[model samples]
Target: MTTQHRTIAFIGAGNMTQSIVGGMVASGYPADAIFVSNPSPGKLEKIAAELGVHTSQDNAEVANKADVIVLAVKPQLMADVCAALREQVAHLADKLIVTIAAGIRISKYRQYLGDDIRMIRVMPNTPSLVGKGMSGLVADDRVDDSDKSFITTAFDGVGATLWVSDEDELDILGAVAGSGPAYFFEFMASLQKAAVALGFDRDKARQMVQQTALGAAEMAIHSELELEDLRKQVTSKGGSTAKGIEQYQAYDIDKISADAVKAAVKRNQEMAELF
Candidate 1:
């Protein structure tokens, strides 16, 4: 909450950028301490009005003012953005650059900046908008302990943070943890609609589906039992649970779920290669 030493900047003033800015403000950082900017006046106005941070249409201005620069733009624009501001960013040699853009590797950032600059790449999901996100962080060798501490607090405002030895694992997680929420949301919606078709009230059906999802997640988190063990425990012979599991197994549900995640991981890897 004590952000007297903070001067954070976000390069793209989009939804995810505002979410992190909101978290920083909520954590006691002065609203004035954050800065966000985009090429569009509309986006700058929207993000600035919402968070009361300084906003500009210039990336270099934001970079000059920030102690930590957050790059939230689409991955396709990263190289151009870097090249555009490369000369102006030499002053940021003492600062840390945190990037939340997916598939943009830290190695790529190193190629853009001077050897003196420190860089870290993070994979954060949209759930951070509700303060329940997951972020995986991996830093370049140039980063110092002080920089890590600051970055830890910066990301902690969003949700849980996991630091990994090899960020390769995160490319897969960008599928499971990053793009994963949508998959489950779709599954829940399907279940709720099925319940409604079976004559349950819409609101009641939704509540049932929500609770079932929450309970299953809690079981996975709190118990030492493996997921398969928990599934086996609930599935007694010839019961409804067993019947559902049997149906799922009969249709090769496991393979289907795996294929979904694999497809995502593969695409993410391909994107990483391109950049």
Candidate 2:
């Protein structure tokens, strides 16, 4: 089915679901074709009012009407959510199941939903809230090209979408693009703190750090140069920028970053086991 004609339902009305819905509406996807449900009416009411989409409190009622169902609940809550919908499993046979929850693997979903379901696992970060998110997707072998195309189009509304050959790669990507925003935020926060220590007011420090970060990101996006080349362009030999780079190198920043990403990947694997 054409993406525009597909009725999409988000099973949870959380921030990520809202972000995706907002992006779709902004991108001119028909809001009327979108349906959202949550146990609580607060978020559903707000989204329906703001975005002109259908809202409901019943998962099966929402799922029954969708060509695509986004499983957007928390990882820990996923099993219970799927179990509740067991009665609807037969009806959902032909629907495309897309999950944004982390850690839980496709095998677990097969156990809960059914082995024959066409499923896709997506890992999207918090940046999706602002339409700058990156999502990694991996689908079951049963998924067809048409379904993949539709899923890509749906997620592309929020940001970029990458299709991986294996679920393990998606987990690694979760460690990078998924947890990456927090890593950048932590660095930005540290810079803000240092600016404050250097006598700038807290608000000024924040503004400086944020704008600098934004500018740097914009530059990287627009430039064809490799990141190392871009850094070299900023760091004239023996200059202040070079000195700052030297300090980062002295502190083994590369190793710190590598280890941090490794830790995140490890935790993702651990969560899969836990769930």
Tens digits of lDDT, candidate 2, 26-106: 888999899999999999999999999999999988888899999999988999999887676446778989999999999
Q: Which pairs clash in the backbone of model 2?
A: none
Instruction: Give lDDT: candidate 1, residue 94.
Output: 79
Question: How would you encode candidate 1's per-residue C-alpha lDDT over 79-122 as one tens digit per residue?
Answer: 98887767776576777788999998777887876566788888
Q: Which candidate is the best by TM-score?
A: 2
Which candidate should be chosen as best, given lDDT against the real structure?
2
Worst 10 residues of 2 by lDDT: 84-93
Q: At residue 177, give the lDDT of candidate 2.
A: 97
Compared with the true structure, the alpha-carbon lDDT of candidate 2 equals 0.91
